[model samples]
Target: MAHTAGGTALTPAMKIAIAVIGVLVVAGIVVIAMLNTAGRDGAEAPPSSAPTTAVAPPTTPGPLPGATPTTGSEVPPPTAAPGTGLPPLAAAEPLVAAPLPKSGSRDGGLVAGFPTSVAEPMEDSDVVSTSIATENTAMQVSLVSSTTTALDEIRAHYRALWTSLGLREQPGDDSTMAFTGEFESLTLNVRTTGTGNMYTIFGVLRTE
Candidate 1:
């Protein structure tokens, strides 16, 4: 030991040893910090072959078996009543109207019982070529081609016409209309065919 001014002094060898220990401690702390940083980076990184969730496609419903699908705004034809002897409702035939006789006889045209004021004859090339009428009662089958009128309009026209004439509308199907008054009754059958541009009107009238 060497005595200095009022204190003991360390030797060169001791000082050198203390300095080396301090350097070793700092180096150890730096290596631990670097290892900790590398571990955190590895934990945060995403793997290249990670599993992913798959999305499914949407499904659509289909019609059932033996079912026919309807198109557009047209309603399906109604079921036939029992024992009517009439075939299942089918598309109407496209009939062209012929020139009428000069005698004003709608013989091959609409039935006679239809009100002349509310009913008008169609064009020469748009009406059925023949008509069926019975005596003592105006029962007729006539087909009139309609290129501009809609089915609802035609239905409404007849409804308003009969109601104004003091007739009550009878319940019927989509292809048929019925009206009954105190002394008269009428039935109208309507259908569209041939590109849906032509309409056929069948009429039956009875008087008391």
Candidate 2:
């Protein structure tokens, strides 16, 4: 006599088929769960709103060579030192004395009626010579040549003048002298006396 299994009346082949169907159902559920998890992770988060770095504006190159730029402040003027006073007196007003005569080639180098006694001796190397008008109305009387002979003559002439006038010649300072005379004014005399060339310069200044 054949006996049936206690659990179910299903055949062995049918039971195997049922087990396979049950596994399939479980796998499908697992796949669905995995897909749901992946979807949750894949959804894009709110688009990032953070700001990006900004680029700086371009700088302009300096004005082209020699070309003046229209922009920028001008340089300040230089300051002068304190108490230095204004720039030296411009030759605006004639520094020279006026009332000078236009005749006789009178110039800054020569004066009219200048005394020969105070005139400096003229050097032979100097192309220009000068003199002062003497009491005898001698013009250009102070100039003497650089040569020894001419110099001796000059010394003798002045020596005679001083002697006649009772004036004394100071020993060493050739540039200065004193003469007391009846002349009415101070005079400048320059002499370039020489046999090679004769030239005279004169200047006269009146003393108050």
Give me the candidate number with maximum lDDT: 1
Candidate 2, 1-208: lDDT as tens digits: 3467775477788899999999999999999999999898778566779998998766965556787656463566798777766677433221123333232423234445433344444443333444443232222233322333353454555456554544434443333333433322122222344444332323333221
Candidate 1 has its poorest 10 consecutive residues by lDDT at 94-103
lDDT, each prediction: 0.59, 0.45
Q: Per-residue alpha-carbon lDDT of model 1 for 1-208, expressed as tens digits?
A: 6588978788999899999999999999999999999999999998789688897655754555777776743567898877978788553321212231121224445543343433444443255433545554334444455445667877777788767766678899998888765445566566676655455554544432
lDDT of 1: 0.59
| Model 2 worst lDDT run, 10 consecutive residues | 92-101
TM-score of each: 0.37, 0.24
